[model samples]
Target chain A: MKLGIDAMSGDLGSAIVVEACRSFLSKNKTDELYVVGKKEELLALESYSQVTIIDAQEVLEMTENILAIRRKKESSMVKTMMLAKNDEVDAVLSCGNTGAYYASAMLFLKRLEGIEKSCLMAMLPTYNDRGVALLDVGANSENTAEQLKSFAIMGSVYAKNVRKVSNPKVALLNIGAEHHKGDEVHQETYKLLESMQEINFIGNIEGKEILDGDVDVVVTDGFTGNVALKTIEGVAKVLVKSLKDGFMSSTRTKVGAVMAKPALKQLMNKFDTKAAGGALMIGFVKPVIKAHGSSDAIAFENAMNLAFDMVSSNVVDKMKEGLK
Target chain B: MKLGIDAMSGDLGSAIVVEACRSFLSKNKTDELYVVGKKEELLALESYSQVTIIDAQEVLEMTENILAIRRKKESSMVKTMMLAKNDEVDAVLSCGNTGAYYASAMLFLKRLEGIEKSCLMAMLPTYNDRGVALLDVGANSENTAEQLKSFAIMGSVYAKNVRKVSNPKVALLNIGAEHHKGDEVHQETYKLLESMQEINFIGNIEGKEILDGDVDVVVTDGFTGNVALKTIEGVAKVLVKSLKDGFMSSTRTKVGAVMAKPALKQLMNKFDTKAAGGALMIGFVKPVIKAHGSSDAIAFENAMNLAFDMVSSNVVDKMKEGLK
Candidate 1:
């Protein structure tokens, strides 16, 4: 398998991407990596026989507009995507501005034949030790009922192939679990999902039930999905901060925190977002993955493994079949 | 002040309501309580001079349709709302079906002039220990830009009068902080809020920032607001449960858990929803508070205190002035 990595755009510099590529190459000797970035920064990866340096002088800023993707054709992000468009790589990974990355993918790779709109799909950890696939987390600010229907099909395909879930149960995320809940778009999407035979449709799931591990795939518009996902992250951060402050208030609790270090570390790992690697941009002709902006070496390596798994499992091909 | 309580509709039964009334009336001798429910169940309150046991044989089920408010006029929820409508009580409180309670409040007390729709407003805990008022939590499944404008006015008045903020900073709850983000309704609402000189408009706030205590009031359509509120609660529950399981995994961790109990308890109290009392049904002529369905005596009493505070603060009059 061959992969293209945009080494300059992440919050952490290209040095970590170099380190991740080295670690990944150490494990998978059969895979080829095309590391795209400034020549001087990525020169460290040249020692590995399986790694090739693809020089792109420009770097996209984190707050760059989506239109910047069209203007900055020589940037690493656009160059990496162009490789996927040309069939030079099976998949491409970047941790750049999400809006810019998505726009670049649409411009270079285009959408699948039967897909109306492309979406970002991420795997979230659940209490049952399994991950649930959530789609349209931030692809489009708004979506039509037909667009949400396409997201369901794409999400189900991802769960089946990449996550290895058989006959995934897809649900609409709304305010209530009842059939007659949510707005006009959601109500119409419910009918579309219920009538389709391509996926196993669960009636509806609320935001609170997303992490309960009851459903394999949850679908919603990008606006609501983005807000809900971030709200969970925000609450977790607040809780962890509060706990740290409480533990340090007195010597007795400080000693207890020392003894509970291992257990707490295990618990943090259980809820870690890094374990899920990164979000996949589905409904495109070629696979595109978006690593978290703050990814370190280990997280970036996990994202690379995800790209390899998607290509090996033929996820995009299966998605095309599901859409048809 | 006179307060009406719906004793039969809560999930915890009338016993907790009775206990709450006793505890409330013990300190608030000047306030009158008109507890409406099955007379036999509420006979314990008859001994107090401040308590009046009003009989209503029927109980509204939690899953009952909103139209049941019209059909079940003799039910405790309707009777309690009727007391407020007749000016026999200054305010009403219920721990009942949210839909039925809102429907009954609209049917009985009616919306204040210039108010297009009534909405549920909730007080959420923030990291800074102050509270933020979130409006349209679950009143209308969908809303128009104009309706959201009304929600902003009502929520601002609530923050000023009920929450006691001097000059409230009002923001529209959205997926992004940008001026051009979100769907059509939110974009229109942003313009409306920006043009209005009455509110201290602070542009848009995302779900993650709702608990940061930077804004005093956040307004949105009911569907998104409900989903966001519940998502915060869900994540908090999952984290607490995981912490419990981790601490119980081994002997050393169990010892640490014993020493960490006080700190953990303090953290829990800091994030507790019960301290906010309950959600107020705003945009009506009178105040209508809905307690959590599973409220115990302490939570129910907090809701009662909320009712007392709203009536005493002349929140309804100020809301009418703000709307004008």
Candidate 2:
């Protein structure tokens, strides 16, 4: 297996991607990884001799127009995606701006057969000590009922094959759990899911139910998912701040904070971006993983590993089958 | 001003309503308090001697048929709302089932003119050490673009009058802040808001930007708001749990939890539902406060004080002028 890595995409420049690729290459030989970026940056990696380097001089700035994905063929991110598009690589990974990667994935790589729209899938931790694989987190915020049902099918395949959750309970995330609840699109989608036999369709799951581990695959349009994803992040920040303030309110508590630093740091790390790789865009022929732009080496490594597993699992095959 | 409180509502029954009313009567000469519920229950209040008793024989059981709000006219919640409609009371307070309260409010108190939909507004703490007010939390999971605009208007007015901010900044929540970013509805809504000269519309706001305190009013449809709201709740719960677990992980940390107990308790109390009181449904001609179903005495008192402020500030009068 071969993989394409856009080693120029994250907010940390080459530090994260270079180190992650170098560290990851140390452990793996079954996969031939191609690092696509500036030739100078590629040479900086001691692991450059161990793997292939595709010199793409184009720089895709984070704040650049998303259409740059099309305009900049020599761009590392775009070229990396192109490698997978032409089947030169099995997967492509990026820690770049999500919109740019998304643009290139569809514009260059194209969607898999039988998939109407690709979804940005995220693995969100559950309150129940598990994970719910969700779709369209920021890809297609506005969706028809048919598009939603399609998302459910795509999400289920990804969860079962990659996440390895058998029978992967699929649910449409709605405002309410009742079959009759939600907007017109959701209500109609509920009816469609209720009639479908291809996936293990569960009833509507509410946002409050996401972390509850009620469903393995939660489907929603991108807008709600993005807002929800951000809201979760925002609230987490608030709570953590509250906790920090709580721990340092007085002299004794400040001392307590010192004694508890290790454990508290460990807990806070769980919410760190580096621990959870960026979202995955599902329903593509080649596995495409996105590391958070603010990701550290751990996140970049995590994205590569996640992409490795995704490509190996043949999740796309199931998606194609389910699409039919 | 006359206020009717459902004595049977709330987790902690008539005692809170009695105390709040007792406090109200003692402080003001131009006040009438009506305890609307089972007379037998009202008798449980020590301060019951100062209030009028209106018999409402029926009770809408929580977690049961939510439509029971419409079915039982004699129910305590329905009676109180009807009292508000008939001018028998200036406002109605309930700590009962939310669905039941909504049904009664729509059936009896009626919608304010030019206000086709009402919203559940909550004050969320911002990263900047201030609060940002968001509306349509879950009142109507599905809403028209016009209704969303109305929420923005109402939210702005409420923030100005109740929160005492001038020239309140208003923003339409979207997947992106860019023009024409989201689906059909949001694109159109964006145009509509941008054209509304009367509103201090600052353009679109993404979810992560919510707690930045850049905008005073964040308006979105209830479905998304509800989802975001619950997601925030879920994340907060997880973070708090993680913090607690972190503190208890080591023996030294276990001792820290005790030393940190006082400050932690104070911080937790600040985040308590009691401090915030219940969700407030703004846009009524008079203040209609919804105390939490599980509210304790402290929470009930908080709701009552909020209600007093709502009236004293005359949020209705301001809405009447701004909305028109």
Poorest 10 consecutive residues by lDDT, candidate 2 chain B: B41-50
For A1-324, candidate 1 gives per-residue lDDT tens digits of 899999999999798899999899888989899999998998889788898899999998998888998889999999999999999999999988888998899888979988888988888988777779888887778899999999999899888898899999999999888878999999999999999989999989988888888899999999888888888888888888888888898898888887787778877998898778988899998899999998899999999999999999998898888888
Please provide, for model 1 over B1-324, each residue's C-alpha lDDT reduced to its tens digit, 9 standing for 90 to 100: 999999999998899999999999889989899999999998889999998889999999998888988888899999999999999998999999998998888888878899988899989988888888998887888899999999999888888888888889999988888888998999999999999999999999988888888999999899889888988888888888888889999999999988877778878988988778988999888899999898999999999999998999999999899888
Question: B224-319, model 2: which lDDT tens digit per residue?
Answer: 888877776667677677778888798988887777777678666656644666777876777888887877666676777777777778788778
The deviation in Å at residue B275 for candidate 2 is: 2.0
Model 1 stretches with alpha carbons more than 4 Å out:
B63-67
Scored on chain A only, each candidate's TM-score is 0.96, 0.93
Give stretches of model 2 more than 4 Å off. Answer: A44-50, B44-50, B127-129
B48 in model 1: Cα distance from truth in Å?
2.2
Q: After superposition, how far is residue A124 of candidate 2 from its true place, in Å?
A: 1.4
Q: What is the DockQ for all candidates, taken in turn?
A: 0.76, 0.64
